[model samples]
Target: MTDNLNEFNKGELIIENKRDKRLDNALLTTYEGDTLLSCVYIEHNSLPELSIDDVDTTTTFFGKQVPFPLMINAMTGGTEQGVEINEALYNISKELGIPMEVGAQDVLMEDMDTAELFLGEIVEEVNRPTVLLSNLHANSSVADIKVAMDTINADGIALHLNPGQEIFTKDGISNFVGRYESIEKAAKEYGDKLIVKEVGFGMSEEVIKKLVDVGVKNIDVSGSGGTNFVEIENLRNFDYDFSELYEWGVPTAKSIINARNISKDITIIASGGIKTSLDIARALILGADMVGISGEVLKYLIHGGYDYAKDYLQELMYKTKIVMLLLGCKNIEQLKKTPYKLTGKLKEII
Candidate 1:
């Protein structure tokens, strides 16, 4: 046990290798299936008297006024490269007043010293009230969850449920028997501060109900149509194939509606394959209080560096406001009340 811990701390070789490979694949890989954003289109208001100048993009999330209802969801953490990515994203978050969740804390849980050398230093350097969230796996204990949150001084903690990813991974843990029990314990202990979310597979009404039953108040419906973990895992291992499950999971738009139908009050965060302003607007109309983005930002940051990524996000914010103006909705609240129609495959799914 001591030797294993020492090896992890020595160079974080395992996580570093995984992180590098995932980053490379994320750049080249294209996910299968629809995000359902294309299936639903927001109604254009011809008589919209609202001007772009009058549109307000600010919305309250995590009990604070965020410039927009967007969050940079968990991406990478726990290695040298992970630290660099976290630092860049953190600077962007600070500049944009956007919320971000640091990548998974598996390494931190395995070796505190490794995390101190990788994620902890960056967290300490960038520590501030920027709506930072700590990320943990679903099977993590409440104690592990607490340590992750405290490490980053997280405003909240996002426990990602990636059963599909785990099931498909070559040597990943497949035992999710007590995941709900873990979530329930965390929710009871932290209440609204606990965000129970899926990795890329959308949450169904049943999943939402179970989470709400466990006292969870925030849910990120990170649906398919983005970075397909099944695909990623497949890329990781060529000896086995899982292509048959490429299009698995619910679409983002439908998942948001499903979550809304289950509970009117749960703070729904729409994510997965969210790239354009139309996607964000459609998500808001479908009952998403917030939208989480990961792949798009990572792509931008990787290809174009920090400035390019920042500019891309700024453009998204602009497009979202333009969408609000076009919809004749001056604010996010009004946008939610705006009417929209589902078409094609999305309507069929509904």
Candidate 2:
């Protein structure tokens, strides 16, 4: 049996077949339904003990101090334009003092020389770092995972589970066998550096417990209601319609609560349909160690380029500080302890 040149890599294949279509589809689908962020009503403090100037909105990732807990989540990569996108993202991540998880790096498995193609030369050539993170599929081998991480000297690596998105993709894989074992192996090898993540399909407490049981300490519960990948893939496939499943997966707010209840130790990144500073505040209140934003940042990047995206993020972070002040929470720790109630759909879920 000979290897098919055209069918070599799923990451490459997804890029080649779709090119900027994925980016375009993502931008188009940035529109989201109720993320249940509305269900989170952070109690206001009539008497905030500390002044706005004294609020400490600081956190850490990769052992480096960040101004806030916001993170730049995975977007697109593994193409020429992807290289440019990554560079811009690097700039923004550096300016904002936050961590960024790059898009899929499975393409580098077949061609390691093209590391610059997937992660950008900026990452390869930089002296000062931005707490960069590499990403790969869940079932990747330890060898493959190492190459992806070592390619750009990533501080951490995110192993993403996107079975819901895959089922909708025309050329996506169906065999998820050994996924748990593969994750366990990566965790054993990488330990605290390995972050198990979901795409837009969200995560359940059961799923998070499985990861926690495997010794995984970082989890990005990229819940539903952002960049509907099912709709994106189904739109690409003229052969069939998966519209009915477009709304699948847990809401972002509830997923945060789920992870918070499961364990106090694991780092939970609340993402999916995160559109505002209040959303960021609500996530922290519900137990997310940090907040992640992808589509909204991508929208800002596409609409106005790097500078616009940077300004948007800076403002978002500033507003998150303001939210902290309003809640009478001087720091991220206080914000987490701030009382809030879950109502509506999210109330029923938890």
Candidate 3:
């Protein structure tokens, strides 16, 4: 594997591939479908009184105190358009005092110079003590990830496991052999800085245990009910119809519970199809320490622009606080203990 920029040009193509596919999906498909988060309702407190001004939304993760638990999930970066999108997202993250993860930096491992010149420059411009997270493919080794981390001074690295997405997408990495081995090696080297995540499909309790065994302490259960990569890839490949697998993978709420059942010590990052403040509140109630929003944030940036995105995020944080006050919960820890009933399909799944 030559580390030439030309060789890595193919990897850059994949970034474009994902970006185009997602845009098309957002335009053509329906995002109105429920994330199933509506099933978990927070118990409303009528008699209880809590000052809305006193509601604290801040939470700690990766040894940093983030103003909010919301994370701008990895979106784009490789080309000129990607840099523009990253710029908007970076600015929004900085303004909101929340964490943001860059899209997979596998491009950097292949072509360091180009990635650094583009994405790295955006990170440098957004430079701060914020909890910026880096990302890469699950099969990436420790050395490959080190380059990604160094590119942005990442507080943590997310290795996204997307066998389902790859299996369908044209030119996708079909061979995920030795991926777990790579994860083990990276975990050994990075310790708690390593985050094993799913693309859209959620992880099972069994898989969570395996990752825990490999010394993984942070897990982002990027479950289904959000962006269906299989459906997106099928949309990319016009000839094939993979719609049968559209509702595949565990829902985000269920996935969080599954991971919680497996380990209480590990940090659980709930993501995938997170659309509203209620969704964020529900995830926290179900044991998620942090929540990641990709499609929602990117959609705002693409459709409404930077200022719109910032205002939307600010409103979301406000709603999250309102939910807390309504539940008589002052902080994230208290919110976790807030009583709630799980009903409908979610109950069956749980």
Per-model TM-score versus the true fold: 0.92, 0.92, 0.91
What residue pairs clash in candidate 1, if any at all? none
- Give stretches of model 3 more than 4 Å off: 1-27, 31-34, 117-120, 125-127
Mind sharing the TM-score for model 3? 0.91
lDDT of 1: 0.82
- lDDT by residue (tens digit), candidate 3, 58-125: 88988889988998888766655566666667767877889888887777766766565335455554
Off by more than 4 A, model 2: 1-18
What is the Cα-based TM-score of model 2?
0.92
What does candidate 2's lDDT look like per residue over 74-151, in tens digits?
Answer: 987887667667777776788777889899998888787668876555655545555888999999988998888888
RMSD of each: 5.5, 6.3, 5.8
TM-score head-to-head 1 vs 3, winner: 1
Best by TM-score: 2
